[model samples]
Target: MSVMRVAGLSGLILSRALAMTVDFTQTESIKKGAGEAAWNMVRYYTGNNTGDTPGNLPDPYYWWEAGAMFGALIDYWVFTGDDSYNTITFQAMQHQVGDNDDYMPQNQTRSLGNDDQGFWLMAAMTAAENNFTNPASNQAQWLALAQAGFNEYVSRWDDADDTCGGGLRWQIYTFNNGYNYKNSIANGCFFNIAARLARYTGNTTYSDWAEKIFSWERGVNFINTDWQVLDGAGNAGTENCTQINGALFTYNAGIFLYGAAHMYNLTSSDTWKQRVTGLATSITTTFFKDGIMWEPPCEATACDTDQQAFKGHLARWMALTAKLADFTYDEFMPLLKSSGVAAAEQCSGSPTSDWKGHSGTACGFSWLKNSTWDGNYGVGEQMNAMSVIMTQLLSEAAAPYTSTTGGSSVGNANAGSNTNSDNLDPAPITTGDRIGAGILTTTIIASLLASVVLMIKE
Candidate 1:
């Protein structure tokens, strides 16, 4: 009996030792390096550098890619509390929203897909939550734009479609490309934004929408019984039943996981918890091989521009899940930390450049790719690397981000009311606790080519 007791005590001691030894290396150099990489990508976008263009969409001013960059900037701000990019973030938001709080669908030649708009909306929602500074005229108005976007989805909900039993279509109009597809990303965005709105406003309507979206996804088998989230169904013709594409993209699981986390946070319901657990488990078991999360198709060579950007979203939400959901924190922390380290190490330790002086390390798309960038250094790659690093820093720092006092008044209080069917006001964009720009812009024109882009097919 004493020997057995000693063995049990030894096991307990070992467990405690391992718990205390969680490997978290959040160095200033590492964080600063990530910030520089992000800025490098931003400079590339503005046409100030000649390293590599974003993707098939040569127009640097594309809204969705810009949204991804903004997301990376937000993560950096949250992790380091550095306001270096505050002006850029503010300016980007200013240009993004139209006079009526609607996102102007202007991306050069490419038609604005629902997922593209949804990405910007998701970024706006993040800006609101993190107390990021906005234009004084639009203070606290991020939620209003978010609501307007959400309302747009609510209105566009095609209940008449027998194919998927009512979900948002990928394209706004039939004239635009991808109109026939009902994708995971489009519905996932709806679920995510609705869940976030529910948390922020404490409104049941948003929760109801969240629940309904999840149900539809489940009913259509897009989210399988095992919780594997497949790609969308192509609505090419009304004659064919909705066919599940079955390609497991990382971002699909990402938004769904985040939405589930938010729902659990807002409602404290066991169902949401179960959903969160199931989804996390599915992502862990189904998505990852050899303990590294990867989008399946691009495991070998370079992923397409869109798929190249997908893993960043997965990393972003996985970190969020670790932060927001207690059930998954313990499980995700080590994975995230290790993944971050692997990603950073894979980046070229020194910057590369041509004779014209454009210089930066291209982070390889695959985390498993332990070499320097063999492909173009576009917006997606930069965002993906920055995202992984910043998430790691934030997780290690364990900062508490509280909402500021003056910015709570959403431009449209009726956003949650579901009654303001009319035009949305030019909501508040107030300033808050943010860093002043007095420091320096020495890094702005440093001339490095970092990477950034998406998949066309549903």
Candidate 2:
């Protein structure tokens, strides 16, 4: 009996020791840990597996999450220089761009919220920004695909009809729940995507839309006096989107921070720079406890799968923000580095027979306990854990490319303009379009090269 008791204690000790296995400073360690975490996260994706469809996740996992997954996978590839998952990521992304080249794939329409579509759109945007391999020259180019989706959202901006003045409603379809709520997240994503598009395209229209969205959010008090972003206001005609939900979410904070950072980068405006600083300060104060990020509303209470994955988005945007607005790199890194290392420690989930016989390093959810796995595992948990760890690899990464930079994705400024009642994409990208894009790229490169040559001659 004593020996059995001793064995049980030893097992518990081993389970608790699962964390602290990852060293954030070492490139190889971070890559190995990120690879393992990514593998575990992808296991939840049966949608594109042997028995499943090409770009979807099976049961209980929503379509929006698949986009989020691809976004993280893109980051994973960029961080570690790994191409193992690129094929699957590419396949899944293309399969979901819908007929209009927007992310409104037919399969997800019934339950698709604006935020859902936005997640997929942002993934395409990420692909364009990072210059992730473009699809077949015959298929949609990344930037054009993103522009197509951005155009669709611009059309959907609810200023004229909605009671919230200018905010996006939570659900796109009226039949869906929360259709009346002009959620902060919906607008936050729209703003986030717009800012990125603005920076990538050098188009003032995108930046102007981003400003309009930011102004609307502030006007409605969704961004309160403290710059702490609140959840959506319930908008049932008379309710007027005024009765605020008064809840905070980490993803919202991250969304706002990243977008503001882009605005700062684009215009070098003090106003945007200040907003970025405020948002980062609020993010750290509200979400971080002892240097690790956490969800205040749902972490202590139970979080649904959707809530579980929120931190990954926060970490993702924060990393991107740090890169885009180099000024905030110092302010953002301390916590990012701490949370990342803490998260890495929890990657050693080797569950024994006493632990339900799980055999891999399944990532845990909570990073509060020192070197202790929280004993929970899922796609959300895995992604959240890996995201923070992968962020540590940022030190080794180059800033993302813009159209004027080395970015190779071809774009259409007007991809998503809906001329038909069916909302079809304006037209398929033609050979002429590709040639025009090539000429544009060549011109930009030539101009840059000429400037360099002139400088050398001088």
Q: How would you encode candidate 2's per-residue C-alpha lDDT over 288-310 as one tens digit per residue?
A: 99888888776775566677789
* Error of model 2, residue 449, in angstroms: 57
C-alpha TM-score for every candidate: 0.78, 0.86
Provide the overall lDDT of each model, using Cα atoms, as 2-decimal numbers. 0.64, 0.75
State each candidate's clash count: 22, 3
For candidate 2, what is the lDDT? Answer: 0.75
| Clashing residue pairs in candidate 2 (N, C-alpha, C atoms within 3 angstroms) | 19-345, 20-345, 47-56
**Model 2 residue 181 lDDT score:** 67
Highest TM-score model number: 2
Residue 358 in candidate 2, Cα distance off native in Å: 7.3
lDDT for residue 226 in candidate 1, whole number 0-100: 83
